[model samples]
Target: MTARALSARSLLRWLSLLALAAGCHVAPIAAQELIAHPSAEIATLTRNEARLYFTLRLKTWPNGRLAKVFVLPDNHPIHQRFTNEILGLYPYQLRRVWDRQIFSGTGQAPITVDDEQEMIQRVATTPGAIGYAAVPNEHPDLRVLQVR
Candidate 1:
C-alpha cells in the first residue's frame, strides 16, 4: 500500500481504539427511585424540591410534619447515581451543603445509611422520611415518590 494510505489507516485504527477506551470508562447511571415512608403524605416532588430535601433545606413536609431525610454513604454507587441523575448535582456538592449546614448550626444533615437495605428500612420506619434507592418493589411499606 502507498505510505499516505498506510498512515491514514493507522490513524483511523488509533481513533477507533481511543473511542472504545473512552466508552469503557464511562459508567452508566443506574436506575434510581425516590422512596419515602408510607405515611409521608407526599406523592410527587419537582427535581428542585427533591434537591432541597436531600440537601437539608426543606425541613418540613407539606402537612407540617418534620421531614426526616435519609441517605446512603457519599461514595456509594446508588447514592452517586441518585445525586447525579435525580438531583442533578455531584456527590461532593451535596456533601458540602450538608457540612456547611452542620457547622453553621442552622441545619442538620440527613441520616446516612450504610446501604440500600438500611436506606429502605429507615425510610420505611421513620415518619415523614424520604430517601432514594434502587427500585424498591420488595418493600411494600416504602412509597415511591414521583419526581417531575
Candidate 2:
C-alpha cells in the first residue's frame, strides 16, 4: 500500500483505541427508556446508587419501600446496554453477583422479563418496580427514572 494509506490506517487504529479507553460505545438511550412505577419515590439515581440497586445490594428505597428491580433477559440488547452503560457492569459480572446471591441465600436476583414490553408492563403494575425498555414509552402509569 502507499505510505499515505498506511499513515491513515495507523491514525484510525489509534483513534479507535482511544475511543475504547474512553468507553465510547455505550449508546445513549433517550431518557424515556429507563422506567419505574408511577408511585415509586425515586426520580433519579446517581451511578453508584444505580449500581447498588442492580447489584442487589440496595434492596429498599430511601422511604423504606422494597425496590423491586426487573430486567430484560441477559441476551436482550436493552439488557446489555442498560447493564453496561447505566450500571457500569457487563452481563456476566451482574450474573456472578446474582449467582452468589442465590447460592449464598443472603440476597436475590432481579426479576427477569422477556422483552421491553413486559418490562414496561411489569414495572408499571408492580408498584415499586424498575426496568428498562429500548424505546420511549407512553404508558400512563409508568414514569421514566433518570440516571445522573
Candidate 3:
C-alpha cells in the first residue's frame, strides 16, 4: 500500500481509540431515583429501610397505608440496577424473597411495570405507590424520595 494510505489508516485508528477512552472516563450518574406519589408520608429512607419495604418486610407506610411497590420486569437493566444500588441485593435474591413470601402465605409480590415511563405513571397516580427510575424532573404529582 502507499505511505499516504497507511498514514491515514493509522490516524483513524488513533482517533477511534481516543474516542473509546474518553467514553470510558465519563462519570456515571446515579443508577436509580426513588419516586413516589406526591402525598406519600415518607420523604427519605435509609438503604436498609428501603430494602425492607422493597423485600415485602414492611408492607405499610408510616401512616398505616399499604405500600404499593412497583418494579420493572426482572430481565430489564433498570431492574438490575435498582436492585443493586438501592436494595443492595441481586434481582434473583429479591425474587427469592418474593417467592418465599407467596409460598408461605405471608405476603405478595410487587406490581411490575413495563418501562420507566410506566413506572413513573403508576407511582405518580397510585396513592401509596413507590418505585424507582432514571432521574427525572420534579413533577407536581410525584415525589423523589432521597435515599439516605
Q: Give the TM-score (vs. native) of candidate 2.
A: 0.77
lDDT of each: 0.83, 0.80, 0.83
Winner of 1 and 2 under lDDT: 1
Candidate 3 vs. true structure, TM-score: 0.77
Which is superior by lDDT, 2 or 3? 3
**Candidates 1 and 3: which is better by lDDT?**
1
lDDT of 2: 0.80
lDDT per residue (tens digit) for residues 19-136 in model 2: 8899897444343367888667878889798889888899888887888999878888888888866776789999999999989998999998788778888998997787887787
Using all chains and alpha carbons, the TM-scores for the candidates as numbered come to 0.78, 0.77, 0.77
> Candidate 3: what lDDT?
0.83
Clashes of 2: 0
Candidate 3: the clashing residue pairs are none
Which scores better on TM-score, 1 or 3? Answer: 1
- Deviating ranges (above 4 Å) for candidate 3: 1-28
Evaluated at residue 66, the lDDT of candidate 1 is 90
